[model samples]
Target: MNRTFNAASTADDVLDGIDLRGRRILLTGASSGIGIETARALAAHGAHVVGTARDLSNAQAVTAAVLSDAANGGSFELVELDLSSLESVRRCADRIADSGPLFDVVIANAGVMATPAGRTREGFETQFGTNHLGHFVLVNRLASRIADGGRLVVVASASHRSAPFSLDDLNFERTPYEPQLAYARSKTANILFAVEFDRRHRARGVRAAAVHPGTIRTGLGRHMGQEVMEAAIEKLSAALVAEGQAPFQWKSVAQGAATTLWAGLIAAPDEVGGRYCENCHVSEVNDGPLGPFAEGVRSYALDPETARLLWRRSEEMVGETF
Candidate 1:
């Protein structure tokens, strides 16, 4: 049966009773918000977690917080990873690869949203470069080291529903770039990346899935102006108060991490690979416009041909074949 959870369900709730002793997990963006909460849940479940962030100091702080509250026998290690740079991704992966333990789950959770237009070190648009391409390269580089039945969970968004893949101007070279469009494009690429990854690796006992964590109150909104934030709040307030919908379409950090935990640790890889998931289950595919908290996958985001093209382009840009 298809299961559905809500914004109030925390990572612990999804992970309750799961025994993960000896499992090793790699989590990105572990310094704050959903990433931190997810790390806490995994560590509490007895996984040997290696959590990464841009700053070693911040990563250490997150590690300390998790370890302080960890159940007996839980552990976490910190690693440095800057997703915006291919060199950084390679170095981080190389370090973990040399660590001698096969990763059982990889959560690609760090991301920026609606930030001012910029370019990564490799000259790709910042959002597409960091949110999708960075993780794409990281996963491919570490693919062989992932355990045979491991899971790769890409933290995508409902924003992908806002726009389909724009192949012609993906790098924003020929068009005026909009932050939302760029974010949507990167998220679309995330789904496509997973589709192709699963196609190539599933037969080898590796599986990939993408997830929408739902809107949550986090530093992810720091880039927006007050008016933009207020407008979003107002819309959400109206949805709950006036329309009798789920009140205030935002999840707490712990709640926001639930679907990711489920996808990473609970869902059967063969049953869920290459699909977009939310609320701890495969979301019902929708064709209409997305509601405040519900969204559907677009055809372009799941197109096999586009996935292959993006994979090839990623390799060309990163100068590494996978």
Candidate 2:
């Protein structure tokens, strides 16, 4: 594929002329933010998009535009899925698995950011459990439902730069709990899950890639106070200016979802499979100091051994094997 997109590109820009009439895609968190734009763009381009949400009523209200704006054969549907509950994940996955239509791509886009310290319905740390473990079970269970030449896109974050995942203390039982660090760990797990998943399924033509949608102001930040957010953004902007990069500014939802669409549908499978992608391209390994505004992926996020280890530990935690 030719390189024409940048951080400023929107989802529509990434798929400007692409036709997806016969394609089928599964997307999570379709009720808000980048997920809404992603579903809109895909369905507008004639793809059959099945979106999952925690509340069917709320999702329906927020996504009327998806149905109203579809062109050609594009369409959208919704299913109930609560990532914090394993039983809910299973029911949703099982229903989709039995529905008979194979998916051309599955985007694990639903997630929680830094929440006050808490646990999931299954007792794992809230961030790790909701953002990582929930998708782990849902995706692995639906593995065979993916088409032979398909894609799995996990929505990770650049915050993985700060994540040093520990096999021990995954639930923060033995150590001090920090909300941001917990979110960082979950983002790392998202990338690592893609790494190992691509390794496992690439032989059969299914490829997985993790994407960092550039920081956007969304409901994802509801837990953070306005003053705290402003201070952090100020500091980040100063750091970027010092490094001679553009001052920090949040991406539009359309811009934020561009990389997810590009990595999932536009980029060659071989180019993006088992990699970390941002700005609509595969990122290089950078083990340097943490830069949330930086471009390169940390070496640990794409480490094969660590990916495998996390896969094993995730399976154990969820009480299922893939």
Candidate 3:
């Protein structure tokens, strides 16, 4: 992959001329935004995509739309997935794993951002539970069901640079809960999960990667009020201007899903397993504090030891073994 795509590339742009006939893909948060475009493009390329949404009716609507317009392409099915609940996660995984064929790729794309302090039904921090732990358990339960030479792509965020992860207090149990840091920590966990998953499963011919979709004005930001969103954008824009980087702007949903598409379908993509990617390329690794609008991955997010530790804690938290 010579990095032919950028932050502005759409899902269809990345999938141009690529064939995916007979492939089976499992994609989370598939009803809207990046998820919908990813599903549309991949299905357009002849991949049978099993897309999950918290609500099945909404997913069905999206599926209907995808199918009605596709003159020639693979198809889509809907699954009910609620990432905030382990019971829901288990049910969704079991349904998918038992009801049909093995998945060729799994894209964990649904997530919440900048949410207020709250706990999941299982008593874990909401963001960590949904963004990392929920996906962790879901993927682990389905790990063996992925076809040989399969790929898994976890959609993380550049906001991961906002804070460092604290293993000792992943749930904000002691430290006061900060919404931004909680979201950042969850995004970092997404990366670490990918790192460890690739390390553990590469021998099985399964590769895992994490992606940072560029800033996009998706429903993921509905949690943030207008004032909060404006202030954060201003802050990041100021930092980017200071760093001499291009000014920040919202990318299209298709553009946002392009890196995820790249992660799952790039040529010889296994070579980049365990890497944090943005703009359809393996981002440079930077040490020390990362500015708000920094471009590369923080070395801390890719730390091998931390990845392993996160894996152990994740299994314990999920109370399951792969």
Best by TM-score: 2
Predicted structure 1: clash tally: 0
TM-scores, each model vs. reference: 0.95, 0.97, 0.94
TM-score of 2: 0.97
Clashes of 3: 0
lDDT, each prediction: 0.85, 0.94, 0.87
Instruction: Give the residue spans of candidate 1 off by over 4 A.
Output: 1-4, 239-247
For model 1, residues 186-241, the per-residue Cα lDDT tens digits are 89889889889999999978899999998888888788877889898897778767
Instruction: Return the TM-score for candidate 1, rounded to 2 decimals.
Output: 0.95
Q: What's the distance in Å from true for residue 91, model 1?
A: 0.8
lDDT of 3 by residue, 263-303 (tens): 89974655569899998888988866666655888888899
